[model samples]
Target chain A: MKTARVIYEDGKHKWIALVRDPNRPDYLIDSNEYLVIDDDDSLLLDPGGNEVFPAVFSALSTEFDPRKITKLFASHQDPDIISSLALWLEFNPQVKCYISWLWASFVPHFGGNKETFISIPDGGMDIMIGSQRLQAIPAHYLHSSGNFHLYDPKAKILFSGDVGAALLPPGEDDLFFEDFDRHIRHAEGFHRRWMGSDKAKRDWCQRVSQLDIEMMCPQHGAIYRGDQVRRFIDWFSHLEVGIVKG
Target chain B: MATVTQDTGRELRRIVRTNEEIKRVVATAFKINLMAMNAIFLAKRAGQTALGFGVLSNELRRFAMDLQKQMSQLREMTYGSVNTVTALVKQARLNRVLERARKESSGSGRSLIDEFMRTRHNLVFARHREQIAALNRRLSQMIADTAQLVELGSVLARSAKIEAAYGGAFSTSLMQVSSDFERTIGEIQRSLESLTKHQDATL
Candidate 1:
C-alpha cells in the first residue's frame, strides 16, 4: 500500500503527495507523485511508471478522483517519471499530458494519440488548472535533454522533478527533510552522476533561486522546505556533475 | 474481501486480454468480405452454366456484409468493455489499498478509513461491479448473435460447394472458391468460440 499526504493546502487548492509504498519491490526505485488541485481542475506531476500505477492510483483515489485528473505534467521522459502514461489515459481519455515538445511524438508509444498531448515548447509555458496558473519552467539537461519543472506561484511550490531527488535508504519514509546536510548526503551521488552538466546545473540553480519557493518537491525521496530550499540550490550550484568514474 | 478484490482484478485482466483477441479475430474476419467479392467475380465468369452457383455466391456476399456489420457492432461493444474494465481494475486496486490502510490505522484514523470504505463500497465499487457484469452479459450476447450469423454463412458456403459441382467447365475454379469460403467461415467460427469461452471464464 502507498500513502498520500497533504503537503500544502489553501482552501480548495491543495498539493497532495502520493509518497512511500512499503510493498514496493527492492529492485524497483521508489518515486513521488504530486497532485495539484486548484478548484475543480487538477494536475498530476511525475505520475511514476507502469509498475507503480496500482499503488499510485489507489493512493490517489483515497483523496481525489483519478479519472478527473485533468492534466499530467511529465517533468522529463524517464520511465520512472511518466511510464504510466498509458494506464492513466486508459481511465480518462479526456485528460491531456504536458511533456516537452521533444517527447510529443515519443511518449505516445506508451499510449494516446495526437489529441492526447499538449506540447510544452523549449522555452516552457504557463499551464492552467481552473483559474490558477502553474509555470512550466525549463530545466533542460539537468538530467534529461528536454526537461522542465513545474512551479505553482500561489502555492510557492516547485515540482523540481529529478533536480533535487535523493536516493534515500530503505524505510526512510519522511516526507520533508529537517536537516539539509543529512538529506544532501543522500542526494549528492544522484546529482553528481545523473545531472550531466555543471552549466545546466548552474542555470537551474540561478533561475530557481530567484523564485520564492516554500517547498521544493523532488520526484524521489524527501522534499526541501523553507530555508533548506535555498541550501539545496547553493549546494547544487558548486557541485561537479556528470562524473566518469571509469 | 481481499479475495473478491483479487478475483475482480483477475477478471478485468481477462476481459482486456479477450478484447484484444477479439480485435485480431475481427481483423481476420474482414478478409471474408474480400473473399466474398472474389466468389462473386468467379460466379460471373461461369455465366449461365453456373447460374445456381451465381445465386449462392450472391447470398454468400450478403452474408459477408451482414457478418461484417455484426462484427463492427461486436468490436464497438468490446471497446466499451475495455474502457469499463480498465476503470473497474483501478477501483479494485483502490479497494486493496483501502483495505491495507484500514489494517494499519487505529482509533480516529481507523474510523475515518471505515467511513471512506463505506462510501466506496456503496457509491463506487459495487456499482462498478454491477456495470462490469452488465457489460459482460451484453458482450456474451453479441458474440452469440455473431456466431449464429456465421452458422448461416456456413450453410451458404456448403450450398455453394454443391452448386459449384454443376458449373461444367468452371467447376474446378468455383469449387476452389467455395472451399475458401468454408475455410474462412470456419476460422471465424473458431475465433467466436474462443471469445465465448473467454467471456464465460471472465463471468
Candidate 2:
C-alpha cells in the first residue's frame, strides 16, 4: 500500500512523490519515487527496485495512466534506483530512461536498452518534458561515481537524489522535514559512509548553493522546504563528509 | 543524428510471437486433458471389458494436466524474459541518442562523455544480458519434463491396446478403438515435441 502525494504543484507542471509502502518487506531498504508531470509528459525519477515494482506501478497507475510516464531518470546505476526498469518497460517499452553517460552501458544490467536511455553529460543538461525544461544537475560522487540530480527551474525544486537521502528510524514517516536538526542526525552517518569524496560533496554544495532552490527533495526520507532548504545546503557545505570513523 | 536500430524492433516482434506460441501450447495441453477425460468416461461405460483402457485414460489425463502446469510455468518465464529484452533494447537506443548528441554538440556534450568514460568498461551490460540467457535454461527444463510425460503416455497406450485385444467377441470395436486412441495420442505427442524443439532452438 504505497501512496503518491503532490508535493509541489503549479497547475499542469507538478512534482509528485510516491512514498512508503506498509506491505513492503522489512529486509529491503525503503525508497521514494518521484514523478515530475509537465502537461502531457511525465518523468519518473529513481523508480526503485524490482521487488517494489508492483506496489510502485499500482500506485503510479492510480495517479495517472502509467502509460503517460514517457521518461525515466536514474541518478546512477544502483539497482534500487533503476532495477524496476524491466517491469516499467513491460508497461511501455518505448519510455526513454535518463541516466549519467558513465552508467549508460552499465545500468542496462538492471534492465533497459540503448534507445531507452537519454544520457546526461557529466556536467548535466536541460531535459525537455513537453515544452518545459528540467535541468539534470551534476551531483557526481555524492554516493555514486556517476550521479546527477533533477532540477525544475519553474518550480525552483531540486531533486537531490541521494545527496540528502536519510534512512529514518521506524514510526517516522513524515513527507517533509519539520525538525531540521533531528533529521540531520539520521542523515549524518549515511553521508559520512556513502558520500565517498569530500571534494565532490563541496563542489555539489557550492554549485547548488548558487541556485534559487525553494525545496530540496531527496530519494529517501523527508523533503526540505523553503528556509529549511537553505539551512540544509549551509549545513552540508561546512560538514566534512566521506571520512568513516567507525 | 541518432538513427534507430532495426535489431530492437525485430527482437520485440519475436518476443510477441514467442508469447503467443506459449499461450497456444498451454491451450492445446488443456484440450488434450479434456479428450483424455472423455476417453476415461467411455471406458467406464464399457465396464470390466475396458478396465485397462479406463486406467490408461486416467494416467494420460494426469500427464496432460501436469504438462499443462509446466507449460504455464514456461509462459510466465517467457513473459519475464521478453520484458527484460524490451527494457534492454529501449535503454540501448536511448544511450545511442545521447552518444550521438555528444558527438554532434562539439565540446558541449563532451564533458559528460569524457567524465563518464573515465572509469569505464564495468561490463554491467554482460551481467544483465545473462538474465536473458538464464531463461533458455528454464525452457530446456520444460522440454525435459514434456519428454518424460510423452514417454509415460506411450507406455500406457501400448498396455491399454494389448488389454483391449483380450475382450469378448462383441469387443472387436473396442480393440480397434483402443488402437486408434493410441495412434491419436502418439500423433499429438509428436506434434508437441516438435513445437518444444522449435521453441528451444528459437529461444
Candidate 3:
C-alpha cells in the first residue's frame, strides 16, 4: 500500500528505494525493495517471489536495469520477504547476496540450496551507495527473529516492512496518500486482528517510535504523514491495555 | 483482540436469548390450561353444592375429564412440541366415549352432547378470549425481552473493553428480566383459573 522513492547522496549517483507490500495486502506478493543508484551498484532489499518480482521491477522504473543490480539483501526468512531472492540472484550473475545469518534457516524454504549471500551482522549493518549510507535497523519479534527495518536516515524515511503495515485494496501502488487517517485505521485493525499478542504490539511500537519517521513507507496501506503518527500510537496503546469505550 | 473477546460475550447473550423465547411458550400454555382446569373444578363443586351429585355432579365430572386431558397435553408441551394439539383434538374423541359412558352411568340425565357443547362454549368462547388476550400481553413482553437480549449480544460482541461494573449490571438486568418471565407464567395461570371455573360449573 505504501511505497517510498527518495534521492540521497553527497554527490555522484542518485538512489531510489521502492518499499513494496509489508503485510499481506490486496496482493500476497509480500514486501520488498529496490535500491537504484546510477551507473554503478543497483541493489534489491528482500525480493519476494512470483507476483512481487514483477511489482519490484516495475517500481524500479525503466532507468534501472533488472540485470545490472549488484546486491540483493534479504532481511528475513518469510517466503514473502525473500522467496524471489534466488530468482533475481540467477538473473544478475554478478550480484552478491546479503542474507541475514540469523534468518539463514529460511533459505532452504526459498529453494536456495547454496549459502552464497554475505551476512549482515546483528544490531546493525551499513551499505554504501556512492557517498550516502543506508542503515539496517534491527527489527526483532516482527513475526520472526531474522528481521530488520531499512532506514534511510538522511531522508528521514523508515521502510518498516511489517511493523507499520496495513492491508489495503489490491494493485494499489500509492506511496503516500493525503487521507492518512484511513491508513491509520487500516494498520490498527490489522495489528489486533491478524497479529496476536499484546507484548508483540507493545514491542513493535517501542522499536518504531525511536526512528525519526518522516515518510512512513510501510509494506501495506497508504503512507501516513506526521499528524497520523501520534494518533496511531495512541490507538495502539488503548487496544494493548484493553480499555474499551462505549 | 476485540473480536476474540466479543465472540465469548456474544455466546453468553445467546443463552439468555434462547431461554427468553422458551419462557414465553411455556408461560402461554400454562395460563390457558390452568384457567380451563379451574373452571371445571369450581363448576362441579357449584353443581354438587346447589343440586345433587347424581344429576349435575356426574355430568360435570365428565366435563372435568375433558379439562384434565387438555391440561395433560399442555404440561407435556412445555418441554417441547410433544402432544399439546393432538391430545386436545383427542379430547374431542374422548368426550364422545365419555359421553356415552355418562349416559350409561346415569339413566336419565341430560344429553352429554348439549352439556359438552355448553362447557366448550364457556371455555373457548366466553373465557378463552380474555385469557388469550392476557397471553398475548405476556408474548409482547417476551418480544421486548428478546430484543433487549439481542441488543445486549450485539453490544457485547463489538468490543471486549467495557468495564466489569457495566457487564455486571447488564447481567443482573438480564437475570431480572428472566425471573419476570417465570413470575408472569404463574400470574397468567392464576388469572385463567378464575374464568375456567365458571364454565366448569354448568357441565
* Lowest lDDT block of 10, candidate 2 chain A: A53-62
| lDDT tens digits, residue span A2-48, model 2 | 78898888889888888888877889888999999988999999998
What is the C-alpha lDDT profile of model 1 across A16-90, one tens digit per residue? 999898888889999999999988899999998877876787778778866588789999888898888876764
Query: Which docking category, incorrect, acceptable, medium or high, applies to candidate 1?
Result: incorrect
Please tell me how candidate 2 rates in CAPRI terms.
Answer: incorrect
In order of DockQ, best first, we have 1, 2, 3
DockQ pick, better of 1 and 3: 1
Residue-level lDDT tens digits of model 3 in A1-246: 224466354344554655653433443544536463634665566666544554454455334545467776666676676665644544444566666677655575554445456677767688765455777776665545666767666666666666667765555546566665556655665665544556756776776677776655555555556766655656765674322334
- Model 2 per-residue lDDT at A148: 94
Runs with alpha carbons beyond 4 Å of true place in candidate 2: B1-203
Candidate 3's residue-wise lDDT over B1-203, tens digit each?
Answer: 23323432442343334334445434554443443343334334444332221232233233334434443443333323122222333333334433433332321223423454466546533443344334334433444443343333223222212221123434343233323333543443443443233223222
Worst 10 residues of 1 chain A by lDDT: A86-95
| Winning model by lDDT | 1
Roughly what TM-score does model 2 have, to 2 decimal places? 0.57
Output DockQ, candidate 3.
0.00
TM-score of chain A of 3: 0.75
TM-score of each: 0.62, 0.57, 0.45
- Residue by residue across B86-200, what tens digits does model 1's lDDT show? 7767667656655655565555445656786687678776787788789889989989998899999999999999999999999999999999989888888888888899888
